[model samples]
Target: MKPIMKISPCILLLLSSFASLTSALTLTVGDKTSVCAATSLIVDGVLDYYQGTTYGGTIGLFKDPYYWWEAGEAFGGMIDNWYFCENDTYEDLIYSALMNQRGSDKDYIPSNQSLTEGNDDQSFWGFAVLEAMERNFTNPPSDQPGWLALAQAVYNTIWARWDTANCGGGLRWQIFTWNKGYDYKNTISNASLFFIASRLARYTSNDTYAQTAEEVYDWLTETSGFVVSSNDTTNAYTVYDGAGISGNCSDLSTGEWTYNYGILMAGCAYMYNHTSDTKWETELEKYVNGISIFYNTSNNNIIYERQCQQSGSCTNDQRSFKSIFSRCLGQTAILAPQHQSDIMKVIEASAAGAAQSCSGGSDGHTCGLNWGYGGWDGWYGLGEQISALEIIQNTLVLQYDAPLTNETGGTSEGDTEAGLDTNDVTNVNEITVSQKDKVSAAIVTTVTLVTFLGLSVWMVL
Candidate 1:
């Protein structure tokens, strides 16, 4: 049963009294990490970091979150949580435990249960992180030189799978068939790939990448539109090898579509950011508007559910996935501040509350892990939490200040005249400084071990 949104007369009177407290809730920048950027980076690192640590491979660029449950799906099933077939690992929990244990009294270690099962929420959470870092780092002023080289490597891996069948306006499968070369195309995973590719194109300023991105994006749009278009339903409903395949191509899980919409909005934002292409921006606008409409009508809370359990009682009741969409909204706010109002406070609150809850555990590390579980349904590292934190921080910025303006009074990319609204500039600036410091600390810790290893090797020689 759905929880009713009822307000009693007495409760209403009490709410009125506390209204001042709510309105006075200032979103000042603090020493705390910015929820948006922090979470994105963490997600990227934890998701992919384990690949190098355990698998000796670059994280596979295209893999859907949840397709294994389908009756005929081949790539979905596995015996262990290591998920050797997909390079999944327990490293994320280890990192999270370390983050919390650092400079703390109680020793908090995630049980071996951390390696229990492979889930998509954690995958997408990580995917969102990597996607944002690669795209943002590759673009203009904040040119992270290291990321360029990294992007090249990941981009090549994605390109290796490109073929005649899945090349133009077709699905790109998340998990691939090694023997067949390149046979399957998972629609949901392909959506994320398109978004990632588009961001890569913007960062590298490569037309071929951009062109391919547009093709994939267009294909996904044509097919995924909830209301089917008259032009082409074939792309929308492409089957697995045959017309009567047990599970059709359009058989997408709600969780999959949630990530799909998120990356779509983000990819579109990146496209506009890099190309200044009105067409891409216009296309993204349609999705943002459409999603907002559907959400409002449904009273849907994407983060409130514990997995996709359709049962009366759930073993784990947690909130997940909403942060990805919220982070996407933050990206969109940066790209097009005018549309910020279109996203409701509920989204921001969901992201913020989830972040706070996740991070409020016994210590920072556990807080992060809990946040990951709250938002993604599995073990989380500091990196994923940092990414979500950055988004939350950015959302708070939009809510408290004007439509759009960084502390530098500089406008976002193409829009120079529209400055961020800062009613209390000093307080806001202080908050940003504090958050930046927290984020910088997290980055240093992650890279510290690698730096030390390199030094040790030099000494040995």
Candidate 2:
């Protein structure tokens, strides 16, 4: 008869620890469900639902009724969630948002509001669509004048408006607005252009996109004076806010935000991957290091907008900044694996903190703005939910073993397994599992043999 084997107390304790660590590192199905529920709540509560004769869509301009730029940001977050979860529930909703909100022509105008010409705003929607194309979420098929076409159209619009007359060669903050700051050439707008150009360059294998990325980078660093070189070589370059009417790049606003650094970081990473240019590598490293300035000292790694986040006075625009930063940072990590460890440390820490801040609400879970505080601050909005969802999804992306394959069938080079393999039982204390299943079987067999030998000796005695 075969003898029964038993696991020792020591082995049991080791397995417990191993399981705990794995659970801590990996997101559970429950967590994903909660995040998805929160997303649905945000969409249902905040977005304006209008059913037209031709089509219907959800408007994300909850804060500013007419401002479709914010809608673009919300839509971007939704796309990220869709990619991470791979749920087709929001697929039609996304398509509706893009089709209904955009202009009739290929212009990609977000809304019909007059003087709504914020180049950055248009670029945000375009960039989101570009991401959709890359993820294979676009309806019309990426190859045949689909999301890629929309993204390129937006790029062309921005390219056409390039102001050599203003800050030398940077895009303006607003394309055509009676509002102030139209003349202001901010770092975000130009960095967005740089990011789009670099990504487009990679996707199309076109030299023009690469050249355009370089042009934007040079204009920001050298011409616009946004990038301030450090005295020490090891220290990465410092980027400042954009210039105003004076058009002097050196006349910086000095208000540092995470998204600005993140955009350029991603752009440089893509450029490096596409061109194998060491300069882009250097720039990527600089921006990665440059993001440290936004990290809260007391918090483990919760990023904050240095300008008003400390005082809890972050505006609607400021509230959504960290998510953008987090998304781009994840992209950079994928493009450049060498920096993954350090980048993951920051990302994991922030995710942990953000997850802790979710308090029960009408939707079961609503996240707040200040994750560093580790508690809900009595505020909730679409922007807050979007930011939390981004961080959570980014954490999943980082934790997953396999590269994420979106609906479109395209896969990233860094894709691997979905999560840690539990079958391989190695040393639980050290968490070293080399052929874990085989090792576990061996341990069980040896223990059973030892028990059987002890029983035989007792019987003989």
Candidate 3:
């Protein structure tokens, strides 16, 4: 009879930990698979086509037959999907679009013509590249420029063009003076800057980025009066559209856009992560509550832009707003896990509605602009596809417990630990031995056992 080998308590704990770690990477079965399928349909059917010119190495924008700015927005959405899905199939396409859209110095100038390309357009692409670097979708190359370096170059150009004389200290909507929207100092550009600065601060551990983020937030809320509390019963603090050049940067436009609030929420969340300041947390809560109050519909609880309520029609730009908002809200959830439940409630409802509305299309998965309504709104564009992809990706990340950075110094199956090196035993010892640590230790043991078994066979020879 074979004798049973006794397993130590330590070994049992380690094995348990290993099991948890392994399960974390495995995709959840039902909704995630459907979401991924929808994403593939959008990428293959809608976004892949060749235009007049190619820049980096591949064909034209992955999102074919769209405006330059919309192309940039779509590129961002696709990059986000790539990050969440952990695939690089779209990398060359993204690289080519970014290259074609860039200026001589990588300034992200989609077009040289005035009013066509603006700070917001450049910032969107820059934000996407920055996200790619943060998520490890792209890494910094030693021999050449990387995503981080390119993003910094774009930020430098934007800093050089900051309009201190006009709106105290904010970016103009357009880069050129002759452009049509040049006089409009919009919330999107400034909030994008704040988001970029906050992320750079976290990535590089630089206080200057934190300071810049704070400055942008202060200028928008205190100086420009773009941030206001809604007079309705919700009374949540909301970010409005920017003041025009005519008002001397005093009068704020009542136009409320989701991306403006979303960017600022993400910026605050990152600032909180970097500084551990409660002020940013307070701001985050305000934004989350504001989004809940204003964007969420009573009947379906799906997100919607208030300005488009009169007509079920949303502009090309507004079509992608909720996706951006969901992505940013997901970031906030990672930063403050306390808010994860609230954020998830909002995201899951929208994703469910989005998935349900994915019928009657030629592909049978083309989503619509209004997620609150039942049926497809007969609108099938790159923007709608991107929005659906974003919500789905955000839901996947949240449901799987995949935070971008592990704050607890614990082992996550598919996530990187933020504060400790996985290879260093000393750092591992410094961390408290939670269930996750036990699992991480089990991983270390498994590798060691493989090495020992290999050596033992060699010795037998």
Best-fitting candidate, scored by TM-score: 3
The TM-score that candidate 3 achieves is 0.75
Error of 1 at 451 (Å): 36
Task: State the lDDT of candidate 2 residue by residue for 1-461, as single tens digits.
Answer: 11112234454344444533431222332266654554454444334322222244344343322246766776777787777777777778777777766664545653343245476787778777777767766566333346666677667667766777666788778765443577688988899988888887777677887888889889888888788776675577787888785835556788788888888898898888778888888888888877887774566777767877767677767777887888887788777888888787787677666655444233334455677765544445555666666676676565443222232254322101211231122211112224554466568658866976898666445
Model 1 segments more than 4 A misplaced: 1-145, 166-171, 174-184, 223-256, 293-320, 344-347, 355-391, 396-461
Question: Per-residue CA lDDT of candidate 3, range 1-461, in tens?
Answer: 10011124454344434533431111122366656766665555345233423455234343222445666666777777786666678787776666656654455653332235577777877777666566655543455456666666666666556677786878888776545678889889889888888877777666766787888889887888888776876647778888887768877687888888888888888888788888888887788888774344565578777777447556666766776787887788777787888887777787776665544243445566666666554555666767776776787765543334324222112211211221122101111235565566568658866975775566445
Better of 2 and 3 by TM-score: 3
Instruction: State TM-scores per candidate.
Output: 0.47, 0.75, 0.75
Candidate 3 — what's its lDDT?
0.64
**Candidate 1 deviates by what RMSD?**
18.3
Summing lDDT over every window of 10 consecutive residues in candidate 1, give the lowest-scoring window.
Answer: 71-80
Clashes of each: 39, 9, 2
Q: Residue 387 CA error for candidate 3 (Å)?
A: 0.6
- Candidate 3 lDDT for residue 104: 46
